[model samples]
Target: MKLALVGDIGGTNARFALWKNDRIESVRTLAAAEFATPERAIEDYLSALGLPLDSLSSLCLGCAGPVSGEDFRFTNNHWTLNRTAFRNALQLDNLLLINDFTAMALGMTSLRENERIQICPGEAEADRPALVIGPGTGLGVSTLLPDGERGWRVLPGEGGHVDLPIGSLREAALWQQLFAELGHVRAEDILSGSGLVRLYRSICALDNHVPHLTSPAEISSAALAGDPVAEEVLSLFCIWLGRVAGNGVLSLGARGGVYIVGGVIPRFSAFFQSSGFAKSLRSKGCMSHYLEGVPVWLVTAEYPGLEGAGVALQQMLDTPNAA
Candidate 1:
């Protein structure tokens, strides 16, 4: 049977799947760093599946970069994708390109009630916007705007690159040190997996203590195991994440609530719930009361972006100009 191809390409991993009549089949993931190019990896995946590439009619790709024309380049990687070339390489009739976070936002519509962990208890206003932010290999930002009696329109954003505002003297000192080292401080600087390690080292540096910083996974493990320094790092990370999330909510005027999507938050959901995330998120000086009414939800769906790619493909097919 003819199938639709869907893929979510991120900085570290790329998830590929075959969608047949709204159902996902033969899903697979590959390390993007292991391959020289995205097309080569796709070729390998198709070859391993024993499927003829030419038989697929349409392909939808959600990539970790801004979609520009027929070619897309990853911000955190060296891979560049040419849609025309990819189409020619795979011999597909139709192709769709989308930002990975945009795909995730669209995928929100398909999420089941059970797939979300509600962090706040307010009723969502359908007329308001919904915000989505996530910390993975990198930070992603997007928003769902109401579409005037229709559903919602997803807008992919680069809010992660916005300047990180320091709220306290301690945070300001940390920011100064980070600025000295990295030149510019963005939300992604302290809101992603690598950002966790940076926060740990920076905190340790302030205390004149030597930090044995390692990978994000190692930091998370130590924190979960009750290591004081690691725990401190995780705490700061959660607080800062909440602060940035609050900024996103304000920027979008998202009364529908905020949704966290990424591999990082799922690792320590309990800690996130109990940590300073919520407190900091709602701690805007004069706007605390306003922010308190906005709820937060953790997206717990697996392969959400893949599901989004399917939705995107379907939308594309239904569009009048999508021959």
Candidate 2:
């Protein structure tokens, strides 16, 4: 069994690791901006490990964007790749590219007890689909369903770009302002890391206060410190996240469970768990019962996408014809 390289590439950082014996090793994270191309970043990672580029048999990446055609451009980063160019450049035999959230959804299969904390308690029905979503540099959404052969299949989509759903007068007022300012208010407009700041500023605008927080981290910190304005921002973030998750659940019939995995939510997990997320998720009129008994968990695994990339790579290797 030859070693394979797996990566989880997001807007901010690129993480690489070696997959061997069904585990991850030689894990290294590189800032995407530091290198001109992914190949260079991988080469640096390999060089630090005292390994040659040819040592690896294959490479699989979970990137933050759509995966298609011979040419691929990253959604959040400046790096782009031509499949033929990348393969020849790396001198690799096999290469697989998948949606980062697809890998994230697959990562759910490998979560341990401590890696996940339950946000909504319910029974996960066997054979039902599970919803995997996260908000980071951008929002990501994917679905996971049992393959009936003891394996799992991932269905990836751009669920983040959907229209922002409004459920209350407060949200409607905020949405109106966002629409007037931005023209189009997608869910990602207020559901991502930058979205936190946008939501904060919007609330500030509504309340006639000057904005104090500039970044997601600062806003979360202030909220945790009992700042009223920041607390509203964080609370609204969780509520909106719940709305999006609930909508996803309705679309995919995700009765298996919901896994919220991302960089932002974990920053203030305690506040998130205590917010109106649950209420908003189940607040759908008439169809509210559809969400009953579906478990929801917050994933805190550091590198689930890396592990998931490895899983996807192994599956491809096992079935060469798999698309």
Candidate 3:
């Protein structure tokens, strides 16, 4: 078995690890803002390992943006990599780049039961498509299509930028408030880390009161500390997550299951699980029965992206016509 460098690169953090013994080891997390470029971060991570780059078989990175061939620009950051630059920088031919969400979806194929907390343990029919959506710096969405013996094929998309739905008066007022200022509000506008703050601000605006700008972490902390406003904002975030997830379930007919993992939801697992999330997911009238049977779970595994990157690399190497 060859050792490989694997990474799950997102807007806020980049997780890197060495793959060996069919798992990720030496996992390291780097704040994206601390490095000037992704290459710099990679070099730093590799340096900490005290290993020569020549010993690594390949570099498989799952980026936050769409991967066009070997070129990619992170969706939430300013780093962009052209194929020539990456190839020259790494000096490896087995490089594989995929959407970060896609990498997460790939990781699900080998998910252990202990790694997830069940929201709805509906009939988990194998071979059915699975949906994985996470909210962090931005909302990430991807699907796992059953690809027979080869493995699960990842379909990554910019689903987060889609239209947001307002089902209640409170939600309607928030949309109106957001739309008045931004001219448009995508699902990500209120579903991500920054979105959590935005939700807080919008809630304040709706109440005709001013709000102190706060980070998502602050809001989460405040919510856990029993701040009514913070709790409301967090509740709304969970509510919308359920709504957006329900929409995905409808669009993909994802009967296999819906796995919710990401920066935001995982941090507030108890709140999310007990919030309106499950109810919202099954609230699709007429189709509620269809969705009720579709399971929704929260992936609690650490370093899922690293695990996924390993899976992707192994699959690529196994391909008969791998480049």
Candidate 4:
């Protein structure tokens, strides 16, 4: 069996799938809290499917962490994976590990026309670069550069930890509060799921209200239900997302457009469409004109990382150094 196995390992959940050719044959997910390591999660997923691990011909893993040499230590989880151990344990002929964001960037090629909602309208130059950023356990960043032959090259980035700039007086005050607590604030500090809660707490504190805030889901739900405090927090999140994305766009010169992916934005797509995201994106003083013409899209595809892992696996197989 020419089987291809792909995994998207996140902090809370690990999604595993078996792919034949370009289509997924079977998919399963497990709670990260239930497993002690990536190997355990993979074994459990395969066991549930009644499949033998030896049947896999090619394996690719997209982990939510930095790939250092041949090993990866997850940022949000306690799993530390060594490529040698993974290969030896699985007895696989070929195995590849890539950053989850890079896998997502590779999967962009397979995105359907309707799977992405264009947030900004502009002329797309086929030769220009495309951007991808998502907020999940943390912020994931990657770029797709045109290879000039109907192909794109995926470049994974660590842009989430970049210094966050204060955009407004409100944002500046929030930064002061955050800085007082954490001393340093990164983009992830104000743009992730946890960041939404932090923003909500900051707003509540600023308004002299009790700082007893709920989870990110509750905040989103309340915002959708017209709660002023939740709405204010969500609005700030969206605006900051736009500002950070615009910074990425400027740095990449991504005239092909930007794609927003992850588990966060899908929940508030309607509110995001109406939020000050576009306004914040185009607010760059001198470079406002340069960014105004760039298009932005929100990726609405389910299992995007799974598809992206498949793409990454295929690319590895096609590369000369693949073994």
Candidate 5:
């Protein structure tokens, strides 16, 4: 019956809610640009919810960066936090901070039967490691390692910043072009929201057409409206995503399931379903059969970050050392 405050803090938005009695209540999302500091945003959310400061037993935050000691700075936003200071200010017994992808990996545990849709066909093994990846403002990667009776523990890292691998002659050309312009073409270079735009522009230039730079939404809309260039961008995006996912699966030895959790994937589900995703995933030369039985699923749960925070807090409370 413990009450906790949970937040999924990202580059663009910070979502807050109260986890009470195994459920989230008073969920609210605040624009990161609207608040100068994280404390200010917390205060505003608390005021909006009319929640008492003393009622919160713990505060758990899923941040979009590497957490070191008591301080962590957001990857996309300008906000920084000193965890010890925040805990003291809130007068809470505990504060938990974890990488955002770690939150997503943990969030997969709370997913409902109806909340997820299978993309690739496979027989997922029970008690095996699970991988969760997504592309939004940036690409994220994390895996859930089964810890026997302790459940799954999240293994998070900066996998998205790794070097991108080109699968074809066309991709090689695009990669060279991007490398020339950006000095280094990372996996996130053409795998994120801004990457969608970059792909569209790169295609425009490749075909000797004037590139009208647009947002990811515009590109998606244009692709749906029968724009050949936009369609190509999405197609390329899906292919790359699948290839990277396949590599991720092999690297992590993930057999339970591979969960796709991000804002961008759901936006173009139909295209992703019909695109070269499955084919590309199984296209790995020597390891083709290794991923044959590993299932791929898209996470459609609402407010998974908050739920993930709740899971982290429950784990903390369960630990004997915490007592």
Candidate 6:
């Protein structure tokens, strides 16, 4: 029997699972910092399951950062992998490495209705592309395009680093401070986990309010507890996320829908559902109506990246000329 392993590796954590019978099993998440290299982590995972290292015939990793060349270094961590060295070490017949967000885009294929929370209700045009944007350690953006005979093709880019769009006078004021301090304020600068703290601090400075919260969790907790300053920060964070999501949809014509997948939003799902996000998303001046029927969903699946790794692997192994 041909056995395969799939992994969704990020800066903070690395989730691994066995791919069998078209599903994921024996799922495990390991701290990225604990292992010297990704290979060691994989070996440790297999060993914990009492499985032989050579039992796996194929390995697929959906890793953070650009995937190319023989030598691959993780973006947020110190781990690196030499593809040829890894393939030889593992005695694998096939090895595939994909951008973590590309795997995230592919993971949307397996989402069931209950697995997602609808942020905006509308009909999805199945033939059009879908936008997948989320924030964790950083913001990630990718487009899932219909490939006709090829099923789906993922278009991955550093859309997170785009200029931060200003929507209101208050936001413009915040931007001025951020730009003054950081020089260039990218979308990821305000939409990520750490970005949440940055936004909170900047807001405090603008309002002459002493910042009582220093982390995303603390800010979110304070917001939920009805602290005025924290509440404003969380609200603006969601609104800005909406603006960015709107931009992505317009750029890709992603009427197939929008899947918001990441760690940050899900932390405050209820707050996000009721925030100004919906209104901000459709706030485009003349093109507002263009986004009318575009559906948006917040993904709630626990291991989507790992599941997407499996999908990517299957696609690659089945296609003879895939590159």
- Using lDDT as the measure, the top candidate is 6
| lDDT string, candidate 4, 1-323, tens digits | 66789988887788889866776658888888888888888888788878787776788988877777976788688888888888888888898887888888877878888889988888777888888899876788899887776556787778889888779998898888888877889989878888888888878777888865578899999899989899888898888888999998899898888899988999999899899999998899999998978888899988888888988787778778878
Task: List RMSD in Å for every model shown.
Answer: 2.1, 1.6, 2.2, 1.9, 1.6, 1.3
Q: Residues 1-323, candidate 1: write the lDDT tens digits.
A: 66688998987889999877765678899999989998788887888998776667888989887788866788687899888788888778788888899889878877889999988667778888898898987788899877784545688778888888788888899898899889999999988988988888888888787888688988888899999989988888888888998888777788888989998888888888899888889888888887877878999999889988888888777777884
Candidate 5 has an lDDT of: 0.85
Candidate 1 wrongly placed segments (more than 4 Å): 33-40, 76-78, 148-151
lDDT (Cα, tens digit) per residue for candidate 3, span 189-241: 99999999988998998887677648988898889889889999999898898
Judge candidate 5 at residue 197 and give its lDDT.
Answer: 96
Candidate 2 C-alpha lDDT tens digits along 38-70: 999999999998888888679999988789999
The number of residue pairs in model 1 that clash at the backbone is 0
Q: Quote the lDDT for 188 in model 3.
A: 93
Candidate 2 lands at a TM-score of 0.95
The true-versus-predicted C-alpha distance at residue 90 of model 6, in Å, is 0.2
What's the lDDT for candidate 1?
A: 0.85
Q: Work out the TM-score per prediction.
A: 0.91, 0.95, 0.92, 0.93, 0.95, 0.97
| Whole-model lDDT per candidate | 0.85, 0.91, 0.85, 0.84, 0.85, 0.92
Which consecutive 10 residues in model 3 have the weakest lDDT in total? 49-58
lDDT-best of 4 and 6:
6
User: lDDT value for candidate 6?
Assistant: 0.92
Clashing pairs in 4: none
- Clash pairs, candidate 1, are none
Candidate 1 vs candidate 6: the lDDT winner is 6
